[model samples]
Target: MYKIVEKEHFSENVVKLIVEAPMIAQSRRPGHFVIVRIGEGGERIPLTISAADTVKGTITLVVQAIGESTRKICALEIGDCFTDIVGPLGQATHIENVGTVVCCGGGVGVAPLLPIIKAMKEAGNRVVSILAARTSDLIILEKEVSEYSDEVIIMTDDGSKGQKGLVTAGVESVINREKVDLVVAIGPAVMMKFVSLTTKKYDIPTMVSLNTIMVDGTGMCGACRVTVDGKTKFVCIDGPEFDAHKVDFDEMIMRLRAYN
Candidate 1:
């Protein structure tokens, strides 16, 4: 059983958990994820590894309670133990000194982008991050994330905080004003798709993380298949990260809505 060592609410619907998983903590890299089940009969859910402490034997997961399983996971307390936990899955983000890197995150996407931005900064890249939400109350990790970023831009759709605009505006501004070596984007499908569209025009190399319906997380179920560059790829094994220029966003949106 995997125990929850800590839990903090990021928002009304988002919760952060520090889970006790020594093996995963020791070896996990940014962009990897974990699959967890609350009990013997609970549904499996995939969560991104936002941070890991190898020495402390813990890994952090930021979960947004958008559905029944996620809601259950969010409601779990500090001492609760999950019946099953599978870990450190998916390809890790390649960290390198890529000159100027821009990390764009929308809402809960900020959680997953935290580690990536930190790693990029540590690798000697100038990290500029964009955090977006509907309002100030929904924005998370802004303070913590800013420490790892050379510059941070905050955007809100309702003008309740920071600049009043979509995250795309910030992304476009940076691409136009600066020499960006790499752009990393993670968020809702629509947001990522639009970001991809915006960057494609500038010929900027952009990467996006995909959160498809995953089962077994090992590529055995074929549930996470996504078309990249017109070829089939599994998000579990091939990548949760892909070149934005090659991804078929429309197909991904349709697949995600299959049962909805």
Candidate 2:
């Protein structure tokens, strides 16, 4: 059992937990995720490892209380223990000295992008980040992201925070002025789709993380299937990350809509 060492509420609906998983923490890297179950009877859910501390032996996860399992997990207190916690699973983000990389994150997506941005910075890339939310309260990790980013722009739908617009607006501002080598986005499917579309026009490479309905965290279940580059790939193994330009967004979006 992994002990919950710390917990904080990011928003009314979003909760962040730091768990004691020394092994996982020691190996965790950007873009890696884990499967967590609240108890023996609970269903396992996949959550990205937002951050990790090797010496401290802890892994941080940000959970949005969207459904039954997530809501249950969010209700646990700091000292609570989870019945099961498995991973630094899946492939870590491919990082290189790609100059002028733009990382776009919206809402809860900000959590997953934190480590990715830091990795890009470590690789000697000028990391520009675009953080977006529907309102001021929904925005998270702005200060943390700004610390790693060479440039950070915030956009809100209600004009309650920094510049009133979508994240794409910030992307457009930067894209118009500079030569962006790559763009990485994580957010709602619709947001990612549009971000990919926008970058595709400029011939820049775009990558996105897909939250397909996953049962087993392994590829055996065939549950997290997605079409990329005209071939079927399982998100569990092949990717939670994929070339955004090659993904069949229409089909992916349709599948996601079914959950709503």
**Candidate 2, residue 226: lDDT:** 89
- What is the RMSD of candidate 2? 0.8
Tell me model 1's lDDT, rounded to 2 decimals.
0.92
Candidate 2, residues 237-259, lDDT tens digits: the string is 88889999999989998987887
> Model 2's lDDT to the true fold?
0.92
Which 10-residue window in model 2 sums to the lowest lDDT?
251-260
- The parts of candidate 1 lying over 4 Å away from their true place are none
TM-score of each: 0.98, 0.98
lDDT of 1 by residue, 144-210 (tens): 7999999999999999998999999999888889899999999998899999999999899999999
